[model samples]
Target: MARPRRIVLLRHGESVGNVDDTVYEREPDHALALTAKGRSQAEDAGRALRAVFDGERISAYVSPYRRTHQTFQSLGLDPAKVRVREEPRLREQDWGNWQDRDDVRRQKAYRDAYGHFFYRFAQGESGADVYDRVGAFLESLWRSFEDPHHPPNVLIVTHGLTMRLFCMRWFHWTVAEFESLSNPDNAEWRTLLLGPDGRYSLDRPFDRWCEPESYGVTG
Candidate 1:
C-alpha cells in the first residue's frame, strides 16, 4: 500500500506594506502586519480551505511572519488542529536594498529578480535561501509522516516567493520552470502528492484555479 501525503501550499493574504509598497524590511518587522483588505482575503481563504476538508483530519504549518499567522487565523481552523510551527525557511525572499522602494521602482526590481531567485540580499535572504529553509521544513514534515496518525492534509501558510519555490521544488521545476510558475494571488491552492516510498508525484497541475481567465495561463 502506498503511504499517502498531501502538502498544500498557501500564500498569505495581502499586507499593508504590500499595498503601500513602501515596506522594505522594517527594523523590527512591523511592516509585516496584514492590512484590512488582507484580513478579508485571509478570512475568505480560511473558509475556502475549511470547506475543502470540512470534516477531514488536517494539520497546518506557518511561517513566523505576522501576515501568514493572521491568514491562518482567518481560516477558522480549530487551534488544536492547527499546529503553529515557525519554519523560517518559508519566509519570503529578502528584497534587501529594494525593500523600501516606491511602487514603480519596486516593480522593476521585482521583475529583475523574478527568475534569478537565487540572488542574495545585502543583509537578507534570496530565493535559494527560501528554498533551502523550506527543504529542511519538508524533511521534518516527512519525518512526522512516520507516525501512522499523521493527518492526510498538511497546510502551509507562507509568503509569495516561498510558496512559489515550494511549488517549483515539488514539481521538479528547473530555473525557467520556476519563473513560469510565479503568481501573486491566494485562494488558489497548489496540491502535491507524496507516495509512501518518499518520492513526490503531481496529483494536480500547478494551476487548478476554477477561474483561470483572471490570471493568464502559463506553460
Candidate 2:
C-alpha cells in the first residue's frame, strides 16, 4: 500500500468528563461535550494544524463521539477543500456502566499494580480489545492508501487511548513497549511522516514509563 505523505493523530481537547471523572458516571461517553477551556484548546490546535499544513488540503477521520466531532468542527479548516468522515472505530474505549468514584479509584489502583494492557473494566473492554479494533482500522486505512483518489495527507481526531493503540498496532510494538509509552496530552498531536523508503516514522518522542534497564516491568 502506498503511504500517505503524512498522518496526524490528534487527541480531542479536554471534555466535561476530563475535568470531572464523576461526569462519566452520569453521562454517556459518546454524549459528553467539550468544556469552555476545551473549546479554546481545540481552536488553538486547529490553528497549529493549519500552520503545519500551510494551506494544503487534507482529509479528516473523526471519532463519532461528540467531543471529537466538536474538536474537528472547531479546527476551522476549509470545509469545501477538506473531506471529513466519521469513524466509529476511533471512539474512546468503552467503559460500560457508569462508574462510581470508589470503583474508578479501585480500578485505577488495580490497573496500576497489574497492567493497563490486560485490565478489563466491568462489562467493558480491555486494551487488547481496542488494539484489535485499531488493527482493523489500519487495514481500512491501507485500503484507502491504495485508492488513487484518496487524499495525500490525513488527520485523525480520536481519544488518547485510541491514539496510543493506533501507534501500537502501526508499529507492531510488544506489550512491554506499549506499556512504556504514555498517552498524549489533551489537544496534543503526533505526526507520522512517510519517508523515501515508503515507511512511516513518528516525528517526535514519547514519554516512557519503563526504562531500558527494567524491560517488561513498571518503573
Of the candidates shown, which would achieve the greatest lDDT relative to the real structure?
A: 2
Task: Name every residue pair that clashes in candidate 1.
Answer: 24-99, 46-75
lDDT on C-alpha atoms for all candidate structures: 0.68, 0.86
Model 1 C-alpha lDDT per residue in residues 14-42, reported as the tens digit of each score: 77766765555443352477878888988
The runs of at least 3 residues in candidate 1 whose Cα sits more than 4 Å from the true structure, single-residue gaps closed, are: 1-5, 25-31, 97-99, 102-114, 193-219
* TM-score per candidate, chains pooled: 0.78, 0.93
After TM-score superposition, the amount by which residue 139's alpha carbon in candidate 1 deviates from its true location, in angstroms, is 1.3
Q: Can you write out model 2's per-residue Cα lDDT over 19-129, one digit (the tens) per residue?
A: 888887788889999999998999999999998877776889999999999999888988876888899988888878677867878887888777778998877888989
Tell me the spans in candidate 2 whose CA falls farther than 4 Å from its real position. 212-219
Looking at candidate 2, the ten consecutive residues that score lowest on lDDT are 210-219
